[model samples]
Target chain A: MIATRPLYTPLDRIGWLNTTIRCVLALLGSYANAVLLGSVIAITLSMPAKDATMSAIMLGFVVQLLAVIWVFYARTLIGAFVGLALPATAAAVVLHLLGASL
Target chain B: MKFDKPRSLRKSMTWVHTWTGLPLGWLLFAIFVTGTLSFYRLEITQWMQPETQQASIYDQGQGLSTATKLLEQYASDAEFWSIGFPTARNPLYQLRWRAPEDKSGPENAKGKAKSNAKGNANGHAQGNGKDKPQRGSNNGHNATSADTAAKKTNAEQSQPAESHLAKGADGDKIKPQQGHRGMMQLSLDPATGQVITPRETAGGEFLYRFHFQLYGMHWSIGRTIVAIATFFMFTAIITGVIIHRNIFKDFFSFRPRKGQRSWLDAHAATSVIALPFHLILTFSGLLFLAGQLLPMVAGAAYNGDPRGFLRDYRGFGAEQAAPNPNAAKLVDISAIALDALKRSPAGIDSINIKRPGKADAEISVTTPEGSLFSGKQSLASLQYNGVTGDFIPATSKEHSAAETIWKFMLSAHMGLFTTPVIRALLFLSGVLGSVMIASGLVMWLVARQREREKLGYLPRGHRLVEQLNVAAIAGLLSALGAYFWFNRMLPADMVDRSHWEINGFFAVWGLCLLHAIVRPHLKAWREQLSLATALLITIPLLDPLTGGNFIWQNWLQGQFAIIGFDLTAFALGLGLLYATLQVKHKLAKAEVTKAVPPASR
Candidate 1:
């Protein structure tokens, strides 16, 4: 009987490093996503300014959790980065334009 | 690139869970334990300050009048005055005031210094006679400071003290002072208008603050560290769920006394049993910290003013109109409370007077929300003319759907609105979280130790982890026991008594760490666990020694908080004792196995 070689070594140092990087990306990417989403909601809502801001902030956490999970589960690093960056950029642009109009 | 493979997601997540969870495991454990205790923060505070056992059952109107009279006597010229009404949990009317700017310095400093000396002398007289010399000198210092204060007051009485604010000659704009704000807080007995001077103790507030702010560090730094740890915890929980395939199988599985398998089973059971709570708590904790962690969004939107963002977000209307300089006489506060109660049957939670002394003083009476879980600060409030007591229409606006959901989430996380049973369930969930983290740390060491034994030699890193596991887990429990013991043992009037309690906690924890490093891992665990058990069990005994009513007495008097605390301590002590026995039995079994040869078996 032959013992099969494991795909990843136990306590692999490089594996640890990669996971750390992903963890950091998860935080940053999710934060960006939250901000973008929150801003859009704030702009679209017709409620009082404070309510709009609060609603955006609350919704932001849900978006953040989704973004973080996506970072870990994405097929490729570049794919994950691209996925997060596109929405973040779009939100930023929309928020800036709305602010200018105000 | 390697992690990008489809099959490697589980493996990669397993790796993530291990590293993220292990590194901050100890800190997360401490935070969870302290935070869980904070759920019963008010109860623990009531128990710790035993002197405040007497509850006042005064009528609301009488209580309000009493509070007002005390304020008038002590802080008539205060720039800002606020009163917090008594509740079932705390039967004292809390009054706080910010003195007019000019009176903040020198005089207040002298008063504080004199109070400190007096406190020290009192503590020395009450404490066991171990330091007579220090007590005598403190007494001397107290005498001198008292004399100086008397002389200074006499001199001031001869001539009017300098007024910080210029008297507004009818229709002058009263400019508020900047930079110099002197604040004072006093708790008054609701039954009698006199101040109730309870012995200074940190009580459960220490645990509440320590969970977030951690002691001896800048608040921001502490908050950031806690937030980062919480993020890792969130990550670990997610990764843990992904990596484990047999969630239901693990949930119902428990094979005790099976060594490593038993530990694994315990960990899985704890994590799975309260998985929802863990998720809610971790997510809500992050949301609670959203303002601090992700301030940029709000800062950018509100031009760097977080308060403005919060105000707009919560829909608090315009600030109270400025004080009417020409208006004479302040309206009676009791009238507002009574009038508001008549209009709204929900009862008043608090009353905020914007400009208490001036004619334009607007009194806002906040009505308590019916639900305990409602996140809003106040469900409804009515504003009234400060001088005439005529009701000004309610200014609190309706919250949007988003805001309402946000508030509900925050309140649900806090469990402040919940009944005692629900709070206990939350606390039990927290206890499970602490256990899950502890078992995970031990499981790591057990697995690693097995691997090292197969490889013939254990590395330094493995040994370090072993030591850390013992120290951080059992050692921390012992330190917590010590904190409670110190609360009872320390002199009531001791100077910096709260600081001493905190220091004692750390000192015991540090000693435990040293013990772990010096002793064998198993022996260290057994010893610390035993110490924790002894300390915890003896805690109830100290209550009697410290002049506190016995558990039975408190139980009879319906002071369940103290009784509950004592009983909980005893139960935890028994749990630790059981753990200690298990450790001893395992150690002895290991010795017997070593003595016998495998060939003979």
Candidate 2:
């Protein structure tokens, strides 16, 4: 849904700048997303703090990996940014509501 | 920036794989190659200092007697004494000890160990309490080995090589050691328990340390760099799998002599074959640095003090030493070590004696490494009463599922807690991983061959890649070969001898980079590979001629580690030789094609 084919079919070229921006967005965005995701898991889990911290960290790795792929897999910049930002925003809000001090 | 149309996912992922894989691929290659070689870190170290070859498997009775006698003489007043038995990995029994803080000479700023005699000495072990995540798993995950392993890299980087101080020459003050917190290590012959001064060679410790934290930089910096690369590597692997499009087919498929396709085929085959290993190692590698990489997880969870998480996770609470004036004769530690070794399949890694001479003294004997599911470095250590020498069974703690999985990954990455066969397999898989990275790098250059040919010249960027590939791949091998050569060439009595060995390694690597920059790309590859091949093939020769036991002697003694080290060196040499010849053939073929018409038709 994020990728709409532009009407002009002849202008199909990938620019280095676009790719770089995409990379920066993906790495930083995915990282931000993963941290919040991990923090949430660490707080919400009903397990021991040590176990929760370790497990959340483990899931963080997977989340970051998937977020990176999603950024690249998306057809547009808006799509990539939104893909990471939406989840990250949700995670942050949930973290706040849970009364966990950041 | 010009906008590009939305591309297919496959195309997009290919770009991701290419960029992520290529830019940092050289660094990754170094990490992979060294990490692979580290599967036999102890064996290689054993081979490097042939003097340690006299050591054989631990004979609990006689070995312990000798070790006990040495400890009595050398470190009687030590706050801590650690004795590590000879396992299949490290055939030498290693001894380490720390002077009490109050006894630290010169405000502890100038801690130094000056051994009474000349021989190979191990210094700075990986401190289990710190630098856990930054350590290579193979650094003898046992307490003693960890300390031994940790201090080794410290010796490589900062301090001059240290030897155990002569009884009368003990310094008034000693500097704190790195890794295992500045513990001093001595190599003891398993048979006689006499100290064997191993040559100050680079040993396997240099490469093992280099693989994780690099050299010549603060460990945290080097570790962070490695961590970042590992993150990139994880990204590459996921993208690689996504972009593969035919993972199962790639597993079964291999194409040779097809240039770009051949390179791609090799990459795919190796990647698919060792897919599980790559995933585990990369992720576990990340987890090792997880405390730093995602401190927020610990910070948020443990109220901002990450140390709290570490302390709780490691189960290390302060143990106050009981000061009992009553003097009791300590029982036989050898028996305890042997008994514990039998019960714990990992074998005895280290025996730490705290307040060793007093009635309330304690002896904790740990197995080689932690269990697959336990968070602790040792699954359950066998403790003994210092004065009475009574056995103390460890209270087994229940492991949660999450902790179990987390610990399992960490233990698996350490590559301990396994039979020799499994270690060998891991080594082979590491070799495959190295190949996978190498081929991927070469394929990138090969994929651009057409553009170069059409332009009749190499672009600046392409030329840069060419030089890096040659230097990082064949050149690194050459440097490694030189390190072994230097180990043999350097005199044993040279001060800071192992440091000299490490210096030779960097020196040769720098020379290789220079050579790569100057020589023609193909010739450079051929030359470096030839040198590596020559060095590797003849490494086994140094074993006997350079004071190490012969392969046959090692075999008769059941020291397969030495034999394995020799044969592996020879095999790697032969592999490099094959690669060299291939490059030579390509060089010759290109010459012919250039001489002939551009197109015969």
Candidates' interface RMSDs, in order? 4.5, 2.8
Clashes counted in candidate 1 amount to: 3
lDDT at position B501, candidate 1? 77
lDDT of 1 by residue, B1-601 (tens): 3553454678767766787799989888889998888777766666676665554433353457766765665566665555666654455565654555533354322211110111221211111111111121222111111111111121122221223211111122211111111334555555554445454556676776667657777656777788778878988898889888899999888999887899889988999999999998887787666666656544445654444564454333345334456644778888778787898786665565655676666666655443433343444346777778888775444555666666666666666456678888999999999999999999887766556666666567777877888888899999999988887788875766767778899999999999988887778889999999999987678776775678888767666777778888888899999999998987787678753222111
Highest-DockQ candidate: 2
Q: Show model 2 residue runs off by greater than 4 Å.
A: A1-14, A98-102, B1-3, B56-61, B102-180, B317-329, B338-347, B368-370, B375-378, B595-601
Provide TM-scores for the models. Answer: 0.78, 0.86
Please report the TM-score between candidate 2 and the true structure.
Answer: 0.86
- Residue-wise C-alpha lDDT for candidate 2, range B168-227, written one tens digit per residue: 111321222232344556666666555565554556767876887788886667877888
lDDT of each: 0.64, 0.70
